[model samples]
Target: MNAAQIHPLARSPLQSGIGASEPDPDAIVASGVHVIDVETRALQALRPRIGAAFVAACRRMLECRGRVVCTGMGKSGHIARKVAATLASTGTPSFYVHPGEASHGDLGMITDIDVVLALSNSGETEELLTIVPVLKRQGTALIAMTGRPESTLATLADLHLDVSVPEEACPLGLAPTSSTTAALVMGDALAIALLDARGFTSEDFARSHPAGSLGRRLLLHIADIMHSGDGIPRVGADATLSEALVEMSRKRLGMTAVVDDDDRLLGVFTDGDLRRALDEGTDDVRTTPVLASMGRNPKTIGADKLAIEAAHLMEEFKINALIVVDAQQRVVGALNIHDLLRARVV
Candidate 1:
């Protein structure tokens, strides 16, 4: 078959303009590089523009008796929402309110004590413009983030933050490309500056994100999820395999901590060890002492350690369970993979 017949789906099956040649791989990569370079330059240019107005915006947020109400339209609205989230998580109380929604009685959410941060690339978005008068009537402070400092919104605002970029990264220069990036970066700068001024600690961040993985790492302690006292499945070192197996089966943790008479863990015996024993052709498995079959110096974690640290220990050692020890290295509790999963720390 000819090449045209074999590749009927080819762009230029007929060698006409019906299908143009494929875009060059280098050109595709260069296009992305160009966009990034443009956005990088835009952010660099914005650095010099950070002056008194930006500091005043942060001071207003810090002084507000109410929340920071961030409102915007279109792509600017998306950036507004992210900015609000960053602010809220970094010790500043903030939330996003769609400008269109604000015109329809949602405006009540903004009070005199609140500071309204309005975002618009052109500073002339009709939805944002419609609510500016109402915000003024309510005696609420206004902060404007826009590419046009001379626009009506900027003129009406108590503080105007100039976010003008050299040009849009979009080839047509119509899409909100570098402009939106500039706004987002400025929002992040404000949030981080406020974070530093407020002395936001990691613990404060964990509280704001209590359901996230970082929260689990920072807030969940081993003691919070471990099985203590009677809940632990422990067998004496001198106990027979049958007794240890019974303990494991009763606890259903797939393993048993082998301990001494003083309740100090001596070692551990798991299903894997049992399998190894059976493969070694040991006769009368029930008669074997747990001490003879147990693994010596098994890995353990302290009760005061983070549960995520315990998870890392389990993964690094390729084990399913760990004995929880006190500061003195005496076993006080026990936990397994299921415990970590239940605590949402895995």
Candidate 2:
């Protein structure tokens, strides 16, 4: 572009601090503060505008049997993509389709049962306007978000959400700043509103994000990771301490459950208990009964509890392992801190 086309704020290489004096720190801070203040005001202005039109837009999306197709051009397109992701992850099915691509056959991705949410700061984005006629013919619902209520795109929309901003944060008044922030915040409001209306819970959100930390905490149960069957270290209450140590070594869980003939848990014999016995010098491992050194009423968890709950219990008690018991207090499984770490639940 020529010099006339260049933005007033654009600086040539030589003017951009190549061996030039350092910029004033106070000026830089003031500029940042001004930008934040402008965006904050934009959001404040957007709040009251979420009335009838916003409600109608949300209603259209919620009733959509297909999906919410978000479309826009330029910087507005970036906001549309993010809004689409937020809507999708928060329970509403949505996706972003670039306006330019929509005009080039990507519009086929949209169906009549779907709602199209189009964004344009000026409400005159050519690419978005070009596809409106086709969308209209297809009987698709249109929700327009723009700064100008009188613009052609707004006039054609079934619902118009006014995102008018008082002023842009950019000093040059050419770049999208406060306008984009208003659009993004408005999108979030719609998504979260629909999320609540749909009774979307954290577990529902976790189902969509199974690979994330929140998913691991909410969906991973103790039974999913606990070692059951032969993996559980256990010995009869009548067994010697030496036999208990052998079970603990073979299972490698740092502990063995002392059980009765019916396999009902009596107590747990851990490495810590053995160390305490050695320090006290009271009994020999080869001759002493496992019950003598075992800790009674040890911390136990149900196999159905969330893995995160186990972590909390372990941290609260300062223990490294826990015996998994069933509803009848029978030893069913075992797990350690390392198992939780391996599952990335901690």
- Candidate with top TM-score is 2
RMSD of each: 6.7, 4.0
lDDT of 1 at 200: 97
Q: Across residues 1-346, which tens digit of lDDT does each residue of candidate 2 receive? A: 4754333234543543334588645445656776887799889988888798888888899899999999999999999999999999999999999999888889899999999999999999999999999999999999999999999999999999999999888868879999999999999999999999999999999999999999999999999999999999999988998999999999999999999888889999999999998888955789988888899989999999999999999999999999999988899999999999999998
Lowest summed lDDT window (length 10), candidate 2: 4-13
TM-score of each: 0.82, 0.94
Off by over 4 Å in 1: 1-27, 228-231, 260-262, 271-288, 292-296, 316-318, 326-331, 341-344
Tell me the tens digit of each residue's lDDT in model 1 across 168-224: 888667889999999999999999999999999998999989999889889999999
Instruction: Provide backbone clash counts, one per model.
Output: 0, 0
Report lDDT (CA) for all predictions: 0.89, 0.92
